[model samples]
Target: MRILVVEDEEAIAEGLKFNFEQEGYEVVVATDGHEALAAVSQTDAEEFALIVLDLMLPGLSGYEVLRELRQKQVMTPVLVLSARTLSEDKILAFDLGGDQYMTKPFALREILSRVKSLIHRHQSIRLSTPAAPADPAPAAEQSSSTQGSSPGRFQFGRVIVNFQTFQVSVGERVHSLTTLELELLKYFIEHQGEVLSRTRILNHVWDEHAEVTTRTIDNFVLRLRKLIEPDPSKPVHILSVRGTGYRFLPFPSSQDVTDEEFAE
Candidate 1:
């Protein structure tokens, strides 16, 4: 697998490259956002499996680079490594389609683990997805798994998720999903209607080695709501269980959601 590490600090950038190379990955280092973009654009024939980006950069800011990548439909998974620890900063990264965000002064082991997971998961998702279908799946197959497809599509409400292309169709709007978003949505679908605790969701969706909090799961759930729910403020498919976790109802009815259990 190949990885692109975009960081202005030469020491940190070289350190990451060495470690990743030792792990048998082809690593490329970009010291600024402009270089990062150039490397990405020029590598069409040999696509990168993952990107580790630093928000603080000399050329275009990390945010600008990320925005441009997503705008251009570059779906390479990005792992944002920044010193900024504010909740808004993390949210902004996710909003810009980052798969994961880690604070600076992080453990090297954790970074390695995250990189491994990101590449592995991305490959799995891509392999599972079929080429775009000629016709929309039949209704009966839509609610459940596509009768005999590998990692078939899943539907709830007016939303249709094409796992192969990582696209979610909600009513008339279509959104390209990040790796994290795709996996979480799949997890929810596989265990629909069950109240899943934040910890369990985290450990299962993200590996147990991930040093992240349950709050991360909540942020992702909030993101998913904006995509799948007709009204995010009043969710019907994804419900919050008072003090527990969340429940996904593929075909929600009046009895499936009570006033007391909708997500915040």
Candidate 2:
């Protein structure tokens, strides 16, 4: 797998590149956000498996790089690394469409684990629903457990997602999600209530051959909640796991389920 390491800290950048290469990945190193952006533009989306970004850098910041990339429709999964650990900072990264984020002072083992997980998750998504496979039978009642048999739409509470059209609706407003966001939401619905780590999301959502971090996952979730949650500020459905990662609270599956139960 080919991966990009974008960081101004020479030692840190070199360490990541060296370690990633040792793991049999092809590494591309960028010293600043501008260079990283240029690398992204020069490379095709299907080429590199992932990008590891640093928030603070010379020329442009990591946030800017991410924002611009998304604006230009770049979909390469990105893993953000920075010293900023504030919830707002993390939330901001999510708003810009980062796939995951990680703070500084992290262990090499943890980084490796995250990288492996992101790659695995992405591979799983690609495999799970291969390009609208041949029709199994006439369409009928569809449930989360039943693969590909429902009308394109799934509705619960104020949320509505159309699998065939890849559209999302929250309350009365309909919004379009990027391919990554759509896939992430589908995965969330399939495994609701489970606390998932950054590694786990990356393994299932991003390409398995890609390199990413947990922070990227947080960012994706933030973006997701902003669109789906009744109020992103006091999100009830997409609960946080404090310092760990995230979990999804599925809609009531039984009569005994309560509102709090559906959200918590």
| Index of the highest-TM-score prediction | 1
TM-score of structure candidate 2: 0.61
Per-model clash counts, in order, read 1, 21
Per-residue lDDT for 1-264 in model 1, tens only?
A: 889999999899999999999999998899998999999989782379899999999979999999998888788889999999988888888878888889989999998998988888987876564323232336654533432234556554467888777888887898888888899987887777678998789878876665456777788889899988878888887898878789877767676666566545
The true-versus-predicted C-alpha distance at residue 217 of model 1, in Å, is 2.3
Over 163-251, each residue of candidate 2 has an lDDT whose tens digit, in order, gives 54446777678775555687888777776667776678888776554334566676678888888877787676667765566676644
Model 2 residue runs over 4 Å out of place are 130-184, 191-222, 225-264
CA deviation > 4 Å runs, candidate 1: 127-151, 209-211
Residue 1 lDDT, candidate 1, scale 0-100: 83
Please provide TM-scores, in order, for all candidate models, with all chains considered together. Answer: 0.83, 0.61
TM match of model 1 to true structure: 0.83
lDDT of each: 0.81, 0.71
Worst lDDT 10-window in candidate 1: 129-138
Give the root-mean-square deviation of each candidate in angstroms: 4.5, 7.4
